[model samples]
Target chain A: MQLDSILFYLFAVQILFSALMTITRRNVVYSAVWLISTLVGVAGIYLLQGAEFLAGVQIILYIGGITVLFLFVIMLVPVSEESKQRRFSSQLWIVLIVAVLLTGELGYFLWQGADSFQMGEPTPPAEIGTVTTNSEQIGQVLFSEYLLPFELASILLLVAMIGAVVMAKARPGAE
Target chain B: MEEILDNPYLQPIIATLLIVAVFPLVAGYMVLAERKVLADLQVRLGPMRVGPYGFLQPLADAFKLMLKEDIIPAASDKWIFWGAPVLSTFTALTAFAVIPFSDKFYVADVNIGILFILAMSSLGILGLILGGWSSNSKYSLLGALRSAAQMVSYEVPLGFTTVTALMVAETLSMQGIVQSQLDKGVWIAFSNYGLMLVPAVVFIIAAVAETNRAPFDLPEAESEIVAGFHTEYSGFRWALFFLAEYASIFVICGIAVTVFFGGWLRPFANVGFLETPLNVAFPILLFVVIGAGCALGAVRVTLAYEKAIMGVLALAMFLVAGLFAIPMINELIIGFFWFLFKVLIFIYVFIWVRGTFPRFRYDQLMQVGWKYLIPISMGGLIVNGIVLLFTS
Candidate 1:
C-alpha cells in the first residue's frame, strides 16, 4: 500500500477512536484530554491532504488554545470527583432519531452516486494543490478578493471586545 | 539500501534523529552555563565539585536524576501526571525542526514554520497545566492557573510581533526570512528606519514570559509556590520538566535571533571591506578567549584534580579553535559559528536578566502585557504595514 493511504487509515482510525472516547469518558479531565487527541488526529488528516498550514492552525488554535481553555474552565467549576449517576443524557432518544435520519439520507446519496464513484478523478483547482502554494493563495484571495469580508470580521471582533469591556465595567451606583 | 541512504525524503528524519541525540547534551550544558553565569553574576562559585570547574556537571546531574527514585503522590492522577512530562518534551523537541541554524541546516522548512512553533509552544503549556492539575495540590493548581493566564495573554504580543516580522520578510519559511534579510540588507528590528523597535521590545518581553523565566516566572515562583506545577513530582519526571524548560529557552532564543538579529549572518554582512576578517577572525577569537580563560584557571587552581580538569577544558577549546582554523572546515562551519555565537549572546541575556530583575507581581505582569505591550505592538505592526505598502 502507498504511504499516503496507510497514513490516512491510521489517522482516520485514530480520530474515530478518540472522538468515541471523548464522548464516553466519565471523568471530565479524561474527556478533555480525549478531545485533544481527536483534535490532533484531525490535524494529521489535514497534513495527509497537504494542507500543512491548516494542520498547524488546527493544532495551535484548537488543540492548543480552545482545548486548554476547556480544561481551565473544567478545573474552575466545582464538581464532585465523579459525574452524577445518570448514565444516558435526557435528550438521547431525540438525538438518536435525528442521527439515524441523517445516516439514511447520507446512505441514499451514496447509493445514488455509486455508479459515478468509479469515474475518473475530478481535477482540483489550479490555485490549490498545484504550483501555487495553498497558504499564499489563501492569503492573496483573503486580502484582495475577500478583503471586505475579512475586514468586516475584524470589525465584528472589535465590537465584541468593546462590548465585553463595557459590560464588565464598574458602575458607580452598583456599589 | 544505497538509494534509501541517499533519499532526499530521509533527510529530515536523519536530522531529527541527530537533534534528538544531541539536544539533551546541549540542554545539559545550558544548565551548567546558566549556573556558572548566574554564579558569576552573583559573585559566587557555582558547581565546582563536578568534573573540572563543573564542566562535567551536566553528566553528573543526568546520572543523579536518573538514579533518583521517581515519586508519584497518592492523591495525584497517575496517568496524566506521567504523560505530562513526555508531552512537554515531545512538543519542545518538535519545535526544533523549523529553527534555521544555517542556510544548509534545519530539519524541515514547512510554509508555516513560525506558526508551527507557535502551535508547539501553546501545546507545550498543556503539559504544565495537566501536570499541576493531576498533582491534586493547591500550590500546583494555582501555579497552573497562573501559567495558563500568563502564557495565553502574552501570546497576543508574541503573535503580533511575529506577524509584523513575517510581513516585512514576506515569507513564512524560517530560511526564507533569513534570505529576505540578506536581500534587504537590514534586520527586521531595524527595518522601517527603527519603527520596528517597539515590536522588537514586545517580542523579547513576551518571549521571556512565555518561557516562564525570571521576572515573569509566576508559575514556578520558588519562594511563593515551592517549585509550582511540579511540586509533587520528583526524580526523572522532574528532570524531564527541567530538560523541557532549557529546550524551550533555546528554541525561543533561536526564534528571536532568526527574526530580529539576522540568523547566521555576521555584522555588516553586505559590507565590502570586512567579510574576510569578520568570518575568519571572529570564531577564532571567540574560542581562543575561552581556551585562554581555562588556561588561566588551570594555572590558578591549587588542587591537582581541579588543575587537571581545567587543562582538559583548555585543550578542548583549543582543539575546537584549531579545527575552525582549517580553511575547508572554516568555510563549512562559519555560518553555524555565527548563528550559535548570536544564540549564546541571547542565552547570556536570559541569565543576566534572571540575575538582575525581581519576579514581577502577578498584577504587574498582567498590567504590562495587556495595558502596555499590546497597544505598543499594535502601533509597531501598523507602522510596519504602512512602510511595506509604500516602499514595495
Candidate 2:
C-alpha cells in the first residue's frame, strides 16, 4: 500500500478505536478522555487532508470546548454505583438495530461519495479566485452568500443567551 | 529511516527538536528572571546566593525539585495524576510549532496557525482541570474548577480580540499576518491611526487572564486556594506545571507581539534613515550595557565562585556584542532579535504587573472578562470590520 493509504488507515483506526472505547469505558472520566482522543484522531484525519482550518476547529471546538464541558460535568457529579455496572441495558437489541442502520447509511454515503473523497485534494468551492486560503474563503462565503443565515444564527444565539439569563435571574422579591 | 531523515521535511522537524531541547532551558531562566524581578520590585535581593547574581538559581531550583520525593496521594487517580503534567507541558509546547520566530523560521507554517495555537493552549486547560480533579483534594478540585471557569470565560474576549487581529490582517497564518503588517507599513495595533488599539489592549488583558497570571490568577490564589490545582502535586510534577505556565506565558506573549506589534521586523521599518542604525546599534548597545553591569558586579563580588561566574558572564556578553557587530550576522539576526526583544518586553510587563497588582477575586475576574472585555472587544471588532469595509 502507498504511504498515504497507510497514514489514512492509521488515522481511521485511531478514530474508530477511540470512539469505540469512548462508549465502552466503565468510568465517565475515562470515557471523556477516550472521546477527546477520538476527536483528536478525527482532527488528524482532517490534517491528513488539506483541511487545516477544519482540523483546528475540530480540536478547538470539539476536543477543547465540548469535551472539557463533558469533563467538567463528569468531575462535578458524584459517581453512582450503577454507573459502572454495564455498558448496555434492556434496550440493547433496539439500539443495536439503530446502530446497524446508521452504519449502513454511512456506508452508503461513503460509497456514493467515494470518488469525490479523494485524499489530499478536497473539491474546491465555487467562486475560486485569488483568495486561496481556506479561512478567507470561509469568511467570504459566510459573509456574502450565507450572510443572512449567519446573522440569523447569531441573533438566535443571542436570544437563547438572553433567555438563559432571564431564566437564571433571581426573582425581584425572592431568593 | 535514512530516506525519512534525508527528506526536506526533516529540516523543520530537526528545528522543532532543537527548539524543544532549548525550551526547558529558556523556561527555567524565565522563572529565575520572574523571581529576581519580583524581588527587585518589592525591594529585595531575590536569590542572591546562587551563581553570580542568582544567574544559576533556576538550575538549583530544578535540581532541588528533581531530587525531592515525588508524591501521589493515596486516593488520587494514579494514571491521570501521572499524565496531567506531561499533557499540560506537551500541549503548551505544541504551540511553538506554528509560532514564527522570524519570517522564514517556524516548524510548520500551517494556514490556520492562530487557530492551531488557540486550540493547543485550550488543551492545556484540560491538563489543569484534570490535574486538579484527579488529585483527590478539595483544594485541588476547587482550583481546577476555578481555572476551567476562568479560562473558558476569558477565552471569549481573547477569541474576539484574535478575530479583530485576523480581520485587520485578513489572514490567519502567522507569517501572513506579519507580512500584512510589513506591507501596510504599520503594525495591526497602530493601524487605523488609533482605532485598532482597543482590541490590542483587550487582547493583552484577556491574554493575561487566559494564561492565569495576576490579577487574573483566581485559580491559584495562594491565600484562598492554597497553591491551586497542583496543590497535591510535588517534586517533578509541580515543576512541570511551573514550566508549562512560563512557556505558555512566552507563547502567549509571542502571539501578542506577532499580532499587535510587528513580528521579527523592526519598528518603523519603512523609515529610511533610522532603520540600519537602529537595528545594528540596538543589539550591540544592549549587550554592551549588560556586560558593563556584569563587569561592575564582578569587580565587587567577594566569593571566588561568584567572581568567576560574573567574569564569565561579562565575557559572554562582550562576545555576543562583538558577534552582532558583524554586518552579515547582524543582518540575519536582527529580525529574530527584534521579535524576541518585543516578546521579552511583554513578558517583563507580565512580571511587572504581577508585582504591581493584587490578585483579582474570582467573581470580579469573571465580571471583568465577561462584562467589560467581551462587549468592548465585540464593539472593537465591529468597528474594525466597518473600517476595513470602507477602506477596502
Candidate 3:
C-alpha cells in the first residue's frame, strides 16, 4: 500500500516536471521529449492500475507513433534556436491563477466529501487473474458489446485517411 | 511500509531493476564482440591494443566516455539534447521487463508480453526523433525523419508476424507458448503452416531493418548523414545512444525467440536417465565422478573423452548454478544465454549481409517496407487468424 502511494507520488512528480519542462524548454525538440516523458508517466500509472494492455498501447501509439510524427514535422520545418525561445502570452498568468483556484476548491470539496466516499471491499487475488483475460475475450468484446463503437472508430479512421490524402495532394494548378 | 515491502508483487519490480542493471554491461561487451566479428570478417584484428585481444575494450571505451568533456551545442536545446539519450536508453531497457528468457524465466511474466515488448520498442523512436530535432542540425533532422518512417513502416509487419506466432501457439504468454512447443514436440517455425514462412522471414528482415543494423542502417548512414540524429552528442551521452541500440538488439532477439523459437526451452526433448526421480540422481552422481576424474588428472590422459566429459561437466555446473540462483535469475540466465545464442546468429547474418550486399537506397528501403512487408504481414495475419480459429 505504501509502495503504491510512493509510485503514485513518483508518477505525479514526473507529470508535473514534464509538464513544466514541456512549456518552459527553449528547444522544440526538448519540449517533445518532455511530452514523451509525460506520456510514459501516464503509462506507468496505467500499469500500476494493472491495465497492462492499455499501458502498452499508450506507449506505442502516443510516445512512439504520435511523438515521432511530431519530431519529423518539427525537423522538416526549419525553426531556429532563437525562435524556439518564444514565450507564452502574458494572459497565461490569468489562466494559471484560475487553474490553481479551481484545483484548491476541488480539493476542499473532496476533503469535505471524504467520509461520504464509498470505498469498496478489497478485491480477491483470484479476481486479479481475471483482469488479464486472453485476447479472445477482448476480441469478443470488440465484436459484440462494443461493436458500435468499434465500427465508429473504423469509420473515423477512414475519414482521417481521406483527409490526410486530400491535405497531402497539391491544390489544382498550385504546384 | 512493512506490508508494501513484504508484498509478493514487489518481487517483480526488484527483479526488473536487477535485470536492467546487468543488461547494459552485457550489451557493452556485445558491442565489442560485434566489432571483433566485423574485423574477423574483414580479415583485420579489431582493437587488439585496448587489452589482451581487446577483451577490455568495452571497459576502456567506458572510461574514455566518462572522462571526455560533455558538449552541448551552442545552437541546440540543452535540456532536450541531454534528455533524448536518457529517454532512448530508458525505453530500450523497459522493453526487457516482459521478455521471457526461458519457459520459467521473466521479470513480470505479463500475459501480453509480446504487445508490451512491441510497444516499448516503439517508444525508443521518440528519443531518436527528439535527439534529431534538438541537435539543431540539418543532417540530424533528416536522419530522425528517415528513422521515424522506417520504424513505423517496419513495425506493421513485425506485429503481424508476431500475431502469426500467437496464432500457432494459441497463447500470448511467452512461457505458455514455449510450453505449447514442448507439448507438441515440434517448433512453431517448423509447424505445418506452409505459407506462414513468408511472414516469418519478412518479420526477421523487418526486425533487422527496425534496429537500424547494417545494410538497413540508412538512419545513421555515416557516409551521408554523418552519424545521423546522434551527430552532435559526445562523451558518456553518446555512449548512452550506443547502449540503447545494442540493448534493443537483445530485446528484438528475445522477442524472436519467444515468438518463433521455443523461448528458454531446450530444442530437443528432455531425454535422459533422469526421466525418473531415481534416475535424476544419476546426472549428479556423474558430475561427482567427472570432478574426481579431473582431480586425479585422468582427464588429461584421455583428451578426446576429456572434451566430451568436460561438456557434460559444464552442463552440470550450469544446472547447479541455476539451482542456487533465484527463479527469476535462473530464468534470466537461461533466457540471456538463449537470447544471446540467437542474437549472435542474427549478428553473424547482419555482418554477413554487411560484407555481402550493397546498401539499399532510401526509396527502395521505403518500398520494401510499405509495399512488400506490410501487405504480406496483413495477409499472413488473416490466414493465421483463420487457421487458429479452425484449430481451436
Candidate 4:
C-alpha cells in the first residue's frame, strides 16, 4: 500500500513537472521533450491500471510516432532565438487571465469533489490475470462486442492517411 | 509485506535489471566478434595487437571510451542533449525485458511482450530526434528527420507483421507463441502461410532500416550526414548511442526469434517428453547450464589471466553445445544461441552491406522505404491474414 502511494506520488510529480515545462519552455524542442514526459507519465498511469497493452501502444504511437514527427517538423522550420523572441503583449495578458480563471475553477471543483471520490480497493492479482489473457480475448472482443467501433477507427485512420499523403505530395512549382 | 516482496513481478524486475547490466558487456564483445568475422571473410587479421588475437579489443575500446573527454556543444540545449542518449540507451535496454532468452529465462512474461518490445524499441527514435534538435546543428537535424521518417514508415509494416504472427499463434504472449510452435514441429516461418515469410523477410529488412544499419543507414551516412544525430556528441554520450544501436539489434533479433522461430521451444518436441513428469525439470536444468556457462565466463574475466579466459570461453562454447543433451533446455539454450547467431549474422550483413553498397541518396532512400518496403509489407500482411483465416 505504501509502495503504491509512493509510485502514485512519483508519477503525479512527474506529470506536474512535465506539464509545467511543456507550457513554460522557451525552446520548442524542450517543450516537445516535456510533452513526451507527460505522455510517458500517462502511460505509467495506464500500466498501474493493468492496461499493459494500451500503455505500450500509448507510448509507441503518441510519444514515439506523433511527437517525434512534431519535433522533426519543428526542426525543419528553422526557428531561431531571435524569431522565437517575438511575443504579443496584449494577447498574452488575455491568455493569462483566462488560464488563471480556468485553473481556479478546476482546483475549486477538485477540492469540493475530494470527499465524494474515495479511493477504490486494488484489484486482486487473480482479477488482473484476466487483463493479461492472450490476444485471443482482445480479438474476440474487438471483432464481436466492439466490431463497429474498431471498423470506424480503421476508417478514420485510413482517411487520415490519405489526407497526409495528399498534403505531403510535392506541388508542381515547389522545390 | 514479505509476501509482496516475494511476488513474481519482483523476479521479472530483478531479472530485467540483471539482463540490462550485462547486455552492454555482451554487445561490446559482439562488436569484436563482428570484426573478427569480417576479418576472416576478407582474409585479414582483425585486431591481434590489443590482446592475443584481439580478444581484449572490446575491453580496450571500453577503457578508451571511458577515458575520452565528454564534449557538449556551446550552443546546444544542455539538458535535452544529455537526456537524449540516456533515454535512447534506456529504451533499447528495456526492450529486452520481455524477450524470452529461453523458455523459462525471460524477465517479464507479459501477455503483450511483443507489443511492449515494439513500443519500447520505437522510443529509440525519440532519443535520435531529441539529440538532433537539441544539438542545434543542421546536419544532426536532417539526420534526425530522416530517421524519424524511416522509423515511422517502417513501424506500420512491423506492426502488421506482428499481427500476422499473432493471428497464427493465436496468442500474444511470447511464451504462448513458443508453446504453440512446440505443438507443431515446424517453425511459424514454415507454417501454412508462405506469404507470411514475405512479411517476415520484409520486416527484417525494415528492421534493419529502422535501426539505421548499413545500406539503409542514410541517417548517419558518414560521408554524407557527417555522423548524423550524434555528430556533435562525444565520449560517454557517443558510447550511449552505440549501446542503444547494439541493444536495438538484440531486440530485433529477439523479436524475430519470438515471432518466426519457436522462442524457447525445442525445434523437435516429442509429445512423450512433454507429457512426462520430467518435463517441468527440463527448462530449469537448461537455464542452470546456460547460467553456469555465463557465470564461468564472468569468473574467468575476474581472474584476468589470458589462459583462464580462453579456457573459460572454450568451456562456455562446449557447455552451450552440450546443452542439447537436455531436450528442453536444448531448445532454450539453442534458442539463445540461435538468436545471437542470427543477430550476429544480421550485424555482419549490416557491415558487409556497408562495405559493399553505396549509401542511398536521400530521395532514393525515402523511395525505398515508402515505395518499396511499405507496399510489399502491407500486401504481405493482407495475404498473411487471408492465409491465416483459411488455415485456422
Candidate of highest DockQ = 4
Docking class of 4: medium
Q: Per-residue lDDT tens digits of candidate 3, residues B1-392?
A: 99998776676677787788888789778878788887888899888665445656888888899999999999987877888899889889988877766544467666777888888788888788878878889888878888889998888889888888887887777767777877876667766456567766887899989998877889899999899989999999999999999889888877776677666654553544433322234334544564555444434434555455455555666565434244545434544455555666776676676666678999999999989889988988887678767866
Chain A TM-score by candidate, in order: 0.76, 0.74, 0.74, 0.75
Q: Is candidate 3 or candidate 4 better by DockQ?
A: 4
DockQ of each: 0.48, 0.45, 0.44, 0.49
lDDT of 1 by residue, A18-44 (tens): 999999888889899989989989998
The estimated TM-scores of all candidates read 0.94, 0.93, 0.79, 0.85
For model 1, the local distance difference test gives 0.87
True contacts kept of each: 0.56, 0.58, 0.63, 0.69
Say which candidate scores most in TM-score.
1
User: What is candidate 4's lDDT per residue for B1-392, written digit by digit as tens?
Assistant: 99988676776777777897798899898788778877876899798767545778998999899999989999998998999999999999888877877755777677778888888877888998889888988899878888888788778777877777777787777777887888766678778645668777877777777788877887787897799988999888999999999889878877886788666554445456553333334434654665566556555444456556656665665565455566766544555654555555666766676556767787887788778877887787778788777776
lDDT measured at residue B187 in model 2 versus the true structure, 0 to 100: 93
TM-score of chain B of 3: 0.81
Over the stretch B156-177, how does candidate 2's per-residue lDDT look in tens digits?
9899999999888878888888
Winner by DockQ between candidate 2 and candidate 1: 1
For candidate 3, write residues A1-175 as lDDT tens digits.
Answer: 6877899899989998998999887667667778988998999887776656677789888977888778777676656754656575779889999999999999987888967567755322233212265455667888999999999999999999999999999999996
lDDT of 1 at A104: 95
Which parts of model 2 have CA positions greater than 4 angstroms off? A1-3, A80-94, A106-132, A172-174, B1-7
Per-residue lDDT for B64-152 in model 1, tens only?
99999878998788899999999999999999999988876778777788988999999999999999899999899889988998999
Score candidate 2 by DockQ: 0.45
